[model samples]
Target: MSKLFNWYSGLGLATKQFIYLFIVTLFLVMVLAYRNLSEAEALLKNQVIRDAELLVGRTNQYIDASLDNVENMLLLLSTRYDLFEDGNEAIAADTLRKFADYNNSIAKTLYLVRTDGKVYANEQVNYDIIGNPMLPELYKLALENYGAINVSEPYYSTMSGHTLAYVLPVTDARRQLQGVVVAEVNLDSLTERIAPMIYQSYALMTRDGNIINRLDSRDKMLPYQAGAYPPVLQESFREQLEAVKIGVSRIEGNHHEMLAVVKSTTNRLGWSLAAFIEEDYFYQGLQQLNNNYRTASVVWMIILLLSAYLLSRSFTKPIRRFVEKMDRLHDVQIVAKLPVTRKDEIGRLTQSYNDMLERIQTLLHKTKSAEEQKKEYELKMLRSQIAPHFLYNTLACISSLAKQQRIDEVRDTIRSLVKLLAFSFDKQSEYVSIEEELEGLRMYMHIQQVRYGEQYTYELDVDPSLLQYRILKLTLQPLVENALFHGISPRNGGLITIKGKLEHGVIRLYVRDNGIGISRTEARKALHDQFEQERSKYRFTGIGLRNVHDRIRIHHGVPYGLRIGSTPGVGTVIRVGIPVLTENDERLGIMG
Candidate 1:
């Protein structure tokens, strides 16, 4: 007993009680409920049988009304004259339109068949023969019996598509066959009508009894059981037809063996309309009620757990407050006044947390200050290196050409070099006008033309108005240098293309190369690592690409950078997306 109590105590007072209720009281309640469920199912079965009988009666009345409507319309067509005339189809159509205005669901237009079995659709001027003439079976039966009635039978129409047609064959004064009046009704109307009568009782089958879903009716009346005529549907069909003849009625579970009342609709065509629900499947209210109970029970269990957690948190609250206070405190000591004065485990925790935060603040200052200085120094190094590196290379190239007796080339190089240096050396502000940037690029491109001697090509397609927009200084030079060094140099001959424009309120600047193309793997690496990973794996390095990525990050925020796409043996394209100013950049405009 003591061991059991200890085990129960370990799970907490609430959970131990929940387990005991689940095993003893819950188990007995479940068994009793199952027995009750059986009794309830039997009771529901009896009630559904009663409900089915009632629904069947209403169903018979509805079907009869629908048939009477179809039959009355057909009878009116028979008494009408000029129906046998050459333009009789038009006359009948006119009659149908008058009826249609009275009831919109009933189309006033009429299709008819001749005494010799010719079918005509609509009385319009463009009447087309639907199919090869066939004898109207319903008309022949009505004529043989001499009964003035509406007949429906299965007939295929090519114009309106193959269908079970409702025909009203009406004769003239001399008992001469005038024509057959026809209406092709949607068959789903009959099937769907009987579907709602029985809950979970649904079936759609033709007169010949073809089941649509994959199931072959596993459990049905013995009469509907597997037999030569497909026993699954036979018994229900018989019961439905009998009910139609003898008022709505429910068949015994032993004979028809169906669960619920069966409803059926037979159009003028004599096609079977039958649907029935199985008894055991009908009453879902109890099952759904039991499920609601279980859901409520689980929800209550979660609520109990949350309540325990909140109770435990009474002790944990002061420690949590101390941690939050420590996080908000920057390079400073935290001295919190204790909220819980209760002599418990938590009050001591609150006192200790305040002491720990006070001690850590003293030693962290020198280390944080040193780290911030190191980042600033690294940024300075990168900034200082860009200008001298370009200037030294440009001046060296001019000097080398001058020594080789190429004074004109040297003079041209120096002139272009001076313009490039002026743009590079300018530190008026962090941002420069794009017009000045383009001027720098043109000078650089001229120097390349002098040295490479048509080996390199450059094109600048930029919006004229966007020239006054502010752009990061020296941003375009690295990209242009990359096109020369990494792209075109990779192959013996190539083309370089540069295009820039403002699209949809953003600047899209692109540089494409037709050279030894970068593979998709290389492009992903360039963008992902900002080309740092590219330097490790491939022969083509990514220094210029990395510099562009860093500058864009420093100017913009995260997520904006170079996107490279290429396929091996094709070429690489670098598209740089940057936010554009909606109006003329006020700062750049003022500086200008």
Candidate 2:
């Protein structure tokens, strides 16, 4: 389960949305389809049972009508004195034959029987009626119910496969029973009369479970037994038949399930008409309906999935574009504005992002301008400090040389001073090539050498490749001057070694002097612009270590600035760190 959750969490927003929508839709569709199918199946079963019941009812009515007709004919014949009189036996037989012929659809034959058990049938006998096993009981029933109609239980005969005897006793005018007129009802003929109403297989059975007429020929005139016929014709179904005049049930049959409906006829025969329908046949239409519903549901699900995919894409497309833009934010000079293509939340987010970029650009422009002004002011201050102080000292040195009458020394000192002034006064740019700055440093050192005279020596050890790279003007000169006056001059002699190198992506320029070095506390103060007042008087210019540090920080950022290291009575090293940039690189902009 945790793994499933992790997998799901890793999916993109669009895929997650699609999965969520599909799952919910699938659940709803399944539930709705199941409910609908269940109801439809129930309704279909009810319809099948209702149809079976209707068929049984109609067939039962037809059977009852046929029985009534045969009974009526027997009653009409019972009133004929010719059928009961002894001398009118021929007339009775001829009358019976004609009556049987007229109602042959229901009656198989007619009989005139005496109380002594003699039988006269309308047709020549295929079987002896006097010797028939049912004759005594039927005759006794006719005698006991004198002048009333009587119906015998079904019996098999050679002439009629299955037959029921409808007996009507004939009496004299004074109500004396002479004989009984019997109409042998062919159950098969009765079944044929109502066959049109019996759509499925059926049976016409007596109240005692005798099947008088059935579509199955093997079961004629046999008592209904479980499993002998359809499995539904069992004891339970028989009990149900007795309980209700019209009823239906579903029961398992021999080959398949069956829908059975039993309807008892409202006649003296007390017979039941049961119709059997195969469950598969009954629900065939419903099965087709179910198949169609399933097909349609699958198609609908496909369409829903497609729609979910499209909807998810529609929502996530803008967010993907927004993320791409954010990735390039720091890599580009200007932040690009995203287009607001909609009035929805994503569009509002895009609008907000564009607004933020505009604000950032404005802040950066203002910051850059302010930093440039600060650097310009610091440069002016450095120039101010250099002009009067250095000019006075150089003029004094030249005057002393002239007073000594050293013409060659005077000419060299004046030429070096002129070169130093030219380098300092030039204001074409605040940044200059390393080679140019080094040349200016050489001129300044020359003037200092004339003043101190053989006290200190200087060395420039720089990578030739670094000469074309740009640095702030007078950046190295202030440090060199501090080394000269504070270190070399104080000791009356020292070696000032100026070194420049490239390390990693930055330029490292170091100035070292083998003279009396300041303590850690004094070095920290000097770098932070907290130098003592006494030391300030000896400084060559107001552009000290602190001024140079601030200029580097303001222009190139805080990481690129001066680091000071010193120990008392040993050498002091001031290392200047700045990004490496050539004359062609953009100054005051992003480093190339």
Candidate 3:
């Protein structure tokens, strides 16, 4: 059983078990009935077909054997032509008699004919056929196909009664053609030869579809015309004769249907023997098979019913034990635990249920701890925004005076430095407004201007409407520092542009500089290269570029981080795409 099956069984729902067992029982019953019927039908049909085909093959073999024998006889007799041609009456008569005696089984009466229309026989018959176009059809067949033996339609010979013959071209001792030799075959003997093939119900038939012999005949019976076969025999036997000339024809006798296997003869003989089997009798055995099948089905169903009853009884104890365990586990002070056993389908199921309960308890503890950590990070962001704005304004004016070579302005510059440092170190918090972050940037800009002494210029194009947008605490401070440090060069001290605007609820910021430009290759390397060997070998510092990139990744995620683009002798532009947030998003806060 899979874990799912065992798990369902262990469940406390009684209705679920009843549904599953009922469905399984109905399905197995239907399948058993369907399979048994289909298999039985195929077996019965295949047996009938095989029997019919086997008889057909036997018939084909018998016909081939007869054809072979008569051909050999024709070849041997065609050599004795001198006695007949020289008009040696005694020798010719004796030769014909001997030929008749030796091939008595197939030959009926020996006769001879010359091309000049003379017919002679060893003995005489009721009809005198001396000069009456004697055997004109035989002669015609011989003219068409000379030197080869032939089988002809049943006909009466003038000197010999009913007969068939094998005709060949006769040659003299000098090997000159003399006349033709006809070896007669008795028509009655054909039926006699096929007598043994006549089985119980069916009789042997000739090629013309006549009943030639019967299995129960006492004396040799002459072939007789079939008045009519039963409807079954006529239809079935005709079809078998037409299609599978070797097998039992579907023939009907009286009211019962019979399947007859028929064989055609060899030696070009026109006889066919067939055996019939009564289909009605064979089908009678099915009633007995059905009775046995019904008994077996009832017995099997009863056995399964008994097994189900025993299984329900055995399951009662395990059900009671499992319920008792659950009842104890429900008590306020009791703990639910499962006993361990070696891995097996049922044992593993019990262990899995216990493991799931432990996992749920651990998850609760982790959720509480994470909530605390979020508050701490939030406070850190607020601290970075709160400090450094107004104090730098005072220090900016004082530093300008001191730069004039006015020694008297020293005291004023010291006082402003004190105020700037105080605002720069304000209390820690998380989310801050953009206006607050901008205020800190203004202060930092003043300090840089005083240090650069008219060589650096800072331009801020921050939209006033977007000042209310919430931003992460130190988001803009690093970007300002980046523009001041790496963004400025000697020829152009620094012309840094800090622009911020809102587009579709997202804050868009940019820091552009008119400094010695970073190459496009350098910009790509700065973003991707981690190992020193992979970075640009050219002497260049990427401290501010690297820092701003890392800070954006840490705050927003890898995708919404800094985008750097530059050209070799042009300037570099750094862009930031960040989400505008609210104070509930404590990771982005304004100064309090």
Candidate 4:
């Protein structure tokens, strides 16, 4: 089954739908047809039994009417004095002769007999029995029965073949038994009378279970005994028969089945009528119905399979077109919109592709502009690195003399200037350790201290752990230079504080001065001096500040940069925030 499914799935969409629809339609039609046929069979069987019951009833009525006419004639004649009075033998014989001739269709012969079992008058075929005893046992029963009519069991008669005799006793007004009148009912003639009542085979049975006349010759010789039916249907048949005097029932056999109905005669005939049909014989029309159903199903399956193929093609055609277009889209900007436009999922996808093309063009233009700006900034940094060499040579000469003369202040000042000049000339690396940056700031402050005497003082308070962390060079020295010149130069006693700490995974360094502070507007200009058209108009020239800001922004993103806060009467604090990075970060961490 799995292999069959794999083979089915490998087929094209149209072919697969065709096969699936065909199989499903066939299965559904077969299931429905089976159910319909089963129901039809049940209905047909019930109709057959109903028809058989009606036939048995009609046959029973016909036989009862005939028997009633015969019995009424016997009763009328038995009470008559003209036929049975004393010294009326010849009249009785003539009367019997006329009665037999007129009712010859029902009764084959009629006879008059004495209660002593002697035949007195014989109507037909009675020449040999004129002086002999006639049906002695039956006549004795009639005598013992007195005035009531008595019916003998079926017997084979020489004159009339198989027949049943009805005997009525003749008596005086006091009910004394005088004689008996006998009428032999011919079974062959009775069968002929009821032959037109039903089309199916039928049988007439006596109360003692005798087979009087069987319409089906095949079953005529088979004697019906007690519990004669198959065991599967015996109990049901007996139950049906016992529930009602006349009803229809089904009887199943090992290789065959039958529908039979029984009806008892209303008149005193002491007989019942039944009709039956075999299953195969009854269901011949159903076989024709099944053939017609199968033929129609085949035709419809073909029609539906063709329709399914067309529908599957219609459903997949658009998807095929979309795939072809996508295969040819080598360049996003040059691609055109799809020609087919319907507001479905495919339409939305086409629109999204068009939007993607526009975004790509915009991103490419911005990327080219950023590349040009980066080259210009590199050129500017190179030009700024070419500083004056004469200042460095002179500071080296002064530092050697101050050390030989033992002038501590002059020697310290020249040493600080030499260190600052050396740090500025080295242009290979843009990032330096925090410790080197702090050392640079300390050297610049020492020169300021020698220039301003005891009025200028500076202190460094920083976390020792952050000494090895990398920061852009010249970040702190510029801020300290600006504070001493702009902030401390105008004050009598001013102090500078450099603080460094790590907070929330960021390195924060602060350079604050306790001097005559600039206004909020002046501090804002100092931070944004690069954007101002006239840069020299601000008190702070901002060359060093802008360089530090640009370097920090170029290395980190815009979020990590320098910020300034100042009040009119209070000092200014410049804070630099950058991601913490050390020499070990190259191997173990992601740097901003």
- State the lDDT of candidate 2 residue by residue for 476-588, as single tens digits: 98888888777767788989999999999889999999888999988888765457424444345677677788778877887899998988899799999999887667555
User: Each candidate's TM vs. the true structure?
Assistant: 0.36, 0.40, 0.33, 0.41
Location of the lowest summed lDDT over 10 successive residues in candidate 2: 215-224
Candidate 4 residue-wise lDDT, 1-592, digit = tens: 9999899889986787777776887789889888978787888877876776777777788888888878987987787644555587777778878787788889877777765544545453354544333467667767667678888877766656678888888887787766778888877888887877764566576776555773343442222334543211234443443343566554542244444544555446567766656666567889898888888888877787777676566645677787888888887656676664868776777777667767887787777766676566556555654234434544555666576785876667777877876876677666779999888877766655554467889889999999998887777876786777667667866889999998998999998998778787777877664443232222211336766776677667788888988876688899999888876773454458
Q: In angstroms, give how far residue 365 of model 4 lies from its true place.
A: 4.7
Error of 4 at 504 (Å): 2.6
Give me the overall lDDT of model 2. 0.75
Residue-by-residue lDDT tens digits, candidate 3, 1-592: 6998887777755445445554577568658766766576556645755654455345446545654555566666576665566567567777767766776676666566777766555553422435323467776766567656666654556554555566777767676666776665555665455444433344444566544332232212222224532112344444444344554445444344445444444224556555555555446666676777778777866665655554454554455665676666753223667775536544665677678667766776666655564454444444433333433544456666777776654564464455445544555653468888777666556555554566788788988888886765556766656555555744448688889898876778888888766777777776563612222111112223454455455556656667878775567788887776666665433221
User: Which whole-number lDDT from 0 to 100 does residue 442 have in model 1?
Assistant: 84
Rank order by TM-score, top first? 4, 2, 1, 3
* lDDT digits (tens) for residues 1-74 of candidate 1: 99987888799654655566546554565576667656876777667756765775565566557656666766
Error of 2 at 407 (Å): 0.5
| Over 4 Å off, model 3 | 1-400, 403-420, 527-555, 587-592
Q: lDDT of each structure?
A: 0.59, 0.75, 0.58, 0.69
Q: Each prediction's Cα RMSD?
A: 22.5, 50.2, 38.2, 48.4
Cα displacement (angstroms), candidate 4, residue 568, comes to 2.4
Q: How many steric clashes does model 1 contain?
A: 8
